[model samples]
Target: MTPMNPDADAVERAVARLTAALDEGRPVAPVRDLIGEHDLAAAYAVQRELTRRRLAGGAVVTGRKIGLTSPAVQRQLGVDQPDFGVLFADMDVSAEAEVPSWRLLQPKAEAEIAFVLKEDLADGDLDAARVRSAVDYAVAALEIVDSRIADWDIRLTDTVADNASSGLYVLAERRLGLDEFEPRETTMRMYADDVPVSEGAGSACLGDPLNALAWLARTALEFGDPLRAGQVVLSGALGPMVPAPPGTRIRAEISSLGEVTATFSEKSGKPEKRDA
Candidate 1:
């Protein structure tokens, strides 16, 4: 019989804990205790297992989302680097007239620049210049980030294991090429119920959104999963994220990329009780 690897076993337990929280339609304690507060690899292991399960259940890989690109946020989370999470087909709520409230636990909204790639970043050194040429277009995006950890009391490992606290994303219809506008210079303002709540510029996101993409490309390549063509990449938040409670209408305007909005339904996604 093959001996069970303790670290691998810990990862499994962490996955199970998170999966249970998701299935129960509620938040749970942070998974950092199980995977260690600083074990990024173990945290990612849990995320990968969750992704595998989602794929097995027929979810398609649409793209990826970068998290913690803001220096302030990194400081808040006590992590010096950014993290990433998979973007699945179902996670795209762009077409929904009103976003379902129950689809998330505790969600916050942030504005971002979404990049749709035209070429693979699998070959050659993926510098900023190389990554820029691969972009097919850019769009304004609103990301509804959710946390499965209770009260969002999370360390870096906790959020990383919980798919970088991803929930749903909405992209603007307007698209722009690199030559049309410089990403680093774009400004952003987000509104909740038409009241301005958050604001920042493109430089808030890892100096530039393109830099975030470049980092993701290099990181993904190192992990043996180089970014591919036609994948949508949410390059990280351009400003602070605000609470997105049920029935709230959120909108974000990017100076050059245009604006995107999402109106959440009033009802929460509370699971119904079932007979044992």
Candidate 2:
């Protein structure tokens, strides 16, 4: 499932090649060997490649995304640890922004709470209170996750090598102060086109979403880039996964954080017909 290689440019080149292929909507294999050989870094290599190209194109990293933090998701990946990704300026969407559906590849919108840090927390006795104390606030968000890799057929190494399949993300406007609600006790309901798609609680996210933030801080430091003040951290998914279709609206209501919505613009195609 993995191969080791040692080319200094292997990771960067592999990322460029893969991003090019994906941008063209062409299929290609995961750059697992490139990651294994250049540096045994799967997640870091993925983000490095994404940012490498994104920066060349003049995009900036606005935040970070933590994936596979759920025990169930970890089990699915056959790994015990989670992975993370960088959030680009392109991924940020205000509450009412229209998200073009064609921009994503197999996108799944997730319901979760996002934390914006006021002070840097780089691994210490970082308790939930300290996590809360270093706060900006919380926002109800929808992460539009799309894998650049084909068929989403990937192993832990394969996915981690693809920026944790981090394609696009969108955020809502409303922000509640740290004292506004309990992060762990909050409950979330996901709606796709007004239908109840899934339901979950904040506890589902690594016991508490803040813990997810903590992990992101620690793990990203391990990956070479530590969390910095004013960095926005998406805690992870709290509800079930659903396919995001064109013209569909994704609404997520967190019991504590209020509701946030993301509208998906229909992909260009034939319009639906009216009944005769």
Best by lDDT: 1
Q: How well is each residue in 164-232 modelled by candidate 1, as lDDT tens digits?
A: 999989999999999999999999999999999999999999999999999999888877778999999
Q: After superposition, how far is residue 75 of candidate 2 from its true place, in Å?
A: 0.6
Model 2 C-alpha lDDT per residue in residues 76-166, reported as the tens digit of each score? 7677766777877766766436886666667778888988888877767666676678778888888888766667766676666666776
Q: Which stretches of candidate 2 lie over 4 Å from their true place?
A: 1-13, 33-43, 122-127, 269-276
Each candidate's TM vs. the true structure? 0.95, 0.86
Candidate 1's C-alpha runs over 4 A off are 1-6, 268-276
Global lDDT of model 2: 0.74
**What lDDT score goes with residue 106 in model 2?**
72
lDDT of 2 at 161: 62
Error of 2 at 94 (Å): 2.1
Clash count for each candidate, listed in order shown? 1, 1
